[model samples]
Target: MRWSAGWHGSAGSDRRPAGGRTVPGLREVWTCGWPEARVRAVGDGPVALAVIGECGADDAQLRDALPVVRAEGWRALTRWPGSYLVIARSGETLAVIGDLAGQHPVYYRTDAAGTWWSTAASALAALDGAPVDVTALAAHLAFGQPDVLAERSLFRDVQRVPGGHLLLVGPGGVAVEPYEPAAYAPVGLREQAPVVRAALAEAVAARIDDRPVSADLAGLDSTTLACLAAQRGPVAAVTFADERLRDDDLAFAARTAATVPGLAHHPVPGAPGTVYYAGLDDLPGLPLTDAPNAYVVTASIKRAVLDTVAGNTPGPGVHFTGAAGDAVLSAPSSYLADLLRERRHRRAWQHALGHARLRHTSSFAVLSRARPASRVDLAGAWWQTAAELRRPVRDWIPQAQRPLAWTPLLASADWMTPDVRGLLADAVDEAAGALSDAPARLSDWSDRQDLARVGANTSGWRALALAGHGIELAAPFLDNEVIRACLAVPADERGAPGQYKPLLDAAFTGTGVLPGFVLARSTKGGFNALAYAGLRDNAPVLRELLGPSSHLAALGLVTEQPVADALARAAAGQPTAQGALHLVVAAEVWLRQLAAAPATWWEEVSGRVAAA
Candidate 1:
C-alpha cells in the first residue's frame, strides 16, 4: 500500500444525546485521541460497540452493553475484557468480536463492499488495497511472532482476529465463531486464593478511574498493580534505572514505594531517560505503518519511556503495566500438565523433577521442554529465541521425534541468506499451520496456550505508544476479571520459581498484599541496560536502517550479508545474535515503516466529537 499516515478517526457514530436515546441507524464515532476508540452503530439494531485497547468500562459500559449486543448476537460479545473490538451489523451481515486475549486486535478485509475491520493492522492494510507479502515479510522475518499463534498478516489480503474467535461476514461468506474463554476448570489452592483475591481487587479497582496512575514496580504483576493501585487514587510507582545494568528494578521499586500508601516512587533514570537510543536514523515513524508493534520498543526507548511517563504524570493519567503477566503468569513445564491431569504419574515425574532442579535443566530437559507443541515450534522459528541458542535439531537437524511441532533453532537457514532461508522456511511452514501439532497437555494448557500467544504486545505496543504521548496504559494483569482469577491457580501452582507470579504470590499472600520483602524478591527485574546500550548507541542508525536501500534488502526479504553478520553477532553478546538482533531489527523496522505508510491517510479530530 502507501505510507505517511497518522490521526485518522470516524468509524462514524455520535450525535443525539441532548435528552439521549436516538437510535435510528446508529453511527457513533468517538476518538478524542490520547489513544481512544469508540465506534458504535446499530440503530436498525443488530450490534456494534467498540473499546479497542485498554478497557474496564468505557462510557457506561457502552451504554450498558448496547442492549446485550442487540439482544444476544455472538453471545453478548464476551461480556467485557481489557482488550476489545466488537462489530455486529445486521444488514449485509457483518460480525466481529475479539477480546479474550486477542488483545484489542481485529484486522479484517472481505470486500466487494461489506467487511472491513480495524484495530489498525497497518491501517486496515492501507484500507484494504492490500499488498506487500514479501512472503509474509519472510514469515515475520524468520518464523514470525508479534501477535501470536499466527492468523497471518504481513499482508497478502490481511487477516487476524483469531483469539477466541467470532468473525462472521455474510452473503454466505467469511465466518469464525467461539466467544470468550470457552472453558477452564480445576480450581484449588484453597479455592484459588479467594478467586485470585477478588479478581485482583476488581482489576485494581477498575484502573483507578479516580485518576492519577503510573504503576509498574518491576514485576509481581507490577507489584500487584502497585499495591492494588495504592488502594485507590494517587499512585506513581514506575521503575527503570539502568546504571549500566547488572541489577536494577529500582531496588524493588524503592521497596515498592516504601510500602504503598499513596505510592510515589518514579525512578526512570538510565542516562538521558531510559537511554534514548539516539536518532535511529529517522527511527521508524509515520505512526509505525502496519504496526504489529513496529519493532517492539526502541524509537529511543519508546521516546524515553514516553518522556518519563508523560513527564512525571499529573494530568491525563494511567500507565499501569505488568505486560501480559509473563504470558498470563508463567510457563515452562506447564506444571507437568497439571501432574498428568491428576492421574499423577508419580506426580508427573515428581513435577518434572522439580522443574529439573529449578531449571538447572534435564529432567529430560524438563520433559521435552514441557512440549506445548514444542514451544509452538520455536515460537514459529524465533522471536523470543535466547535460551542459549534455542534448538531445533540443536546444532541443526538432529532431533529424533517428540519435538517436531516447530523445530527451527536454525541448524541450516544459517541465519538466513540462501534466499532468506527459503523465505524463512515458508514462514515457518505457515506458522506451523496455526499450531496444535498435538496440544492437549492440560492444566491450563500452559495458561491456555499462553493466552493465545499474547498478540499485540511489548505491553500492548507500550499501550499504543502511550497514545502518541498523552498516556493511558493500564494492565491490571489483562483483566477479564483478572484473567478469570488467574485461571484459578493450578497450572503447577502458577510456575513457582521463587514465586514471582505464583498466583501473584498466592494472591497477595492470601491478601495481606505485600511484605515478605515485596513478595520474596528472588529475581524478577530487568531493563537490559537500555537494550544493551542500543547496540552501541544506534550503531550508525542501525547501519542505515539495515542498509543497501533495504526494503528488507529489496525483497529477497533480507540478505545484505546476513545484515552485517547479524550485526556482528548481536554486537558480541550473542544470545543467538541477541535474539537475532531483535528479529532482524524488528524486521527491518517493520519493512521500513510499512514502506513509508500511506495508502489513503486521514486524521483530524478534536475534543468531544467536535462538540456537536
Candidate 2:
C-alpha cells in the first residue's frame, strides 16, 4: 500500500498542504511507507533531486550528480547501483523516472489544472473515482504482456508510464519519453559474465543492511541468490518440501546448505491448506494490488513460506526471491527466429534440430515456425496476431504446441467472449499501429515483455509480503544494472539448446559463490501436483466466485460456462486451461477488491480542483 504522489500547476487551494514537501511551480509531494533513511534529497527551491527506494548512493553523490541530471535528461540518473525512483525538478520542469522493470511503475492523469502522478495507479484512479477499463483489462488477460496498451492503465483515464520510460511534466505539458532503448548492441556472453556477476552482487549488497536476510533455495536462480546473500552474513534459507512434489529441489537445497557457510536451512513441510487457491474465500484478507496479480492465486503457498521465515526472524526483514531470473537469464526458443533473421542459416538449423529433439518434434516443424516469425517484424506480427484473434475461437492447444509469433496467443483468448476478443484485437491493432520504433528482433521484444510481466506480478507479491508479514521482497534479477548486463549478450547464446540458463552459468561458474553442483544441475521443478490439488479441493468456492455475478462476466470479458468447464476438466484430471483460469480468477478477485476499496489514497486539501 506504499505510494508517493505529487502534482505540478497553479496553487488555487486555500487550505495548507498536508505533511509533505513543496517545490517550485506550486508543486507538492507526499509519500507513505517510506522511511526517512529511504528518502534522500539534494538541492533546494527550483532545482532539487529526490530518490526514494534502496538507492546505493550517499547524499554527496546525489548532490554531485544533480547538476548533470538537470542539464542533461533523466537518463543520467539511472546509473546508480540499486533500484530506486528519481524525481527531479529544475525551473518549471519536473521529471519522474521509474525503473526499467515495472516494479516501481509510474502512473499519472493530466487535466487543465495540472498533471498528477503517483507510484500507485489505484491511488490516482481513486482521485476521480474512475471505473476499470474493460478493453485494457481484456488486453491484459488475453496477452499477459504489459505494453499491449502501453499508455493505458487498468483504470480509465489513468495513464501508465511505460517501462524504461520517464514522465516529464513541464510548462508546456506532460510527456512520456524513453530513457533506454528496447535492445542493446550484442555482446558475447563471455565478455558480459563478469559484468553480470558484479551487477548481481551489487544488487544483493544493496538490500543487505542491519535487517535479517533470507532467500528461497528452491532452484538455481534462488539458490544463487541465497548463496550470494550468505557471502555477506547469515541467511535463513527456506525450502518448501511436499511429498506430492516429485522434484529434487529439497534434496539439492539441503546439499547446498550443508556445503555453504552462513546458510541455516529451514525446510517447510507443505500441508493441505498450503495449496493454490486455498484462501480465495476470504477476499477481504488479500492485499489490494495495483492490478490483477498472479500471486493472488498462489498466496497460500507463499504465506506458508513467509510464516516460516517470520518464525525464524522475529521482526521486519528482507526476503529475496528468484522471481524474474528465468525471464532475464534465459531467452525463449523463439531466439531461433532472430538467428534466421540475421542470415545465420547454419546456426538456425542447428538450433532448430536441438530444440526439436528436446520437444520431441521434427526439426522442420521447429524451423517452419521460426521461418514465418523471422519474416515478420513486430508490427506485422501484431497485425497477424490480431487477425487470428478476431477469427473463430480455436480448440484448446498446449502453449508449447502453438505456433511462435511476436506474441503468442495463450489459451485464455479462447475463454473470452467474441465481443471482448474483438475489442482486444482492436486494441492490439492500435498498439501495433503505434509501434513505429519497436525492436527489430522478436527475441528482443519478447524478452523485455516477459521481464515486465514478471516484474509487475512480483510487485504484487511484494505488497502481499509487506502487508501480511512486514517483509520487503527483493528480486535481484530485475535490478536495472543486472538487466543491462545480462540482456546485452545475444539471446541465442543465452538460450542455446541442451543447456539450462547458459547466461547464469557463464556468469557464476568458477566464481566460488555458487556451488559447482548447483551450476551443473539442469533439472527444474514444478507445482502441477499442488495446482491440481488446490483446484480439486477448492472447486466449490471457485465455482461460486466465477458464477453468475462474476464482474468479468458482467463486463463481457470472460464467459462463465467456459471457465466452469475448465474447472470441471481440472477436477477430472484433464489437460485443462489452468493458466487461463488463473488469469480469470485473479482478475475477478481484483475487481471485487477494487469495488470494496475505500478512497483514502490522498490527503485532504480544501479547494483542490478535481481531475478532468
Q: Pick the candidate with the highest TM-score.
A: 2
TM-score of 1: 0.31
Task: Report clash pairs, candidate 2.
Answer: none
Could you list the CA RMSD of all candidates, in the order they appear? 24.1, 2.1
Error of 1 at 84 (Å): 2.3
Q: What would the TM-scores of all predictions be?
A: 0.31, 0.96
By lDDT, the best candidate is: 2
Q: Residues 254-311, candidate 2: write the lDDT tens digits.
A: 9999999999999989999988898999999899888899999999999999999999
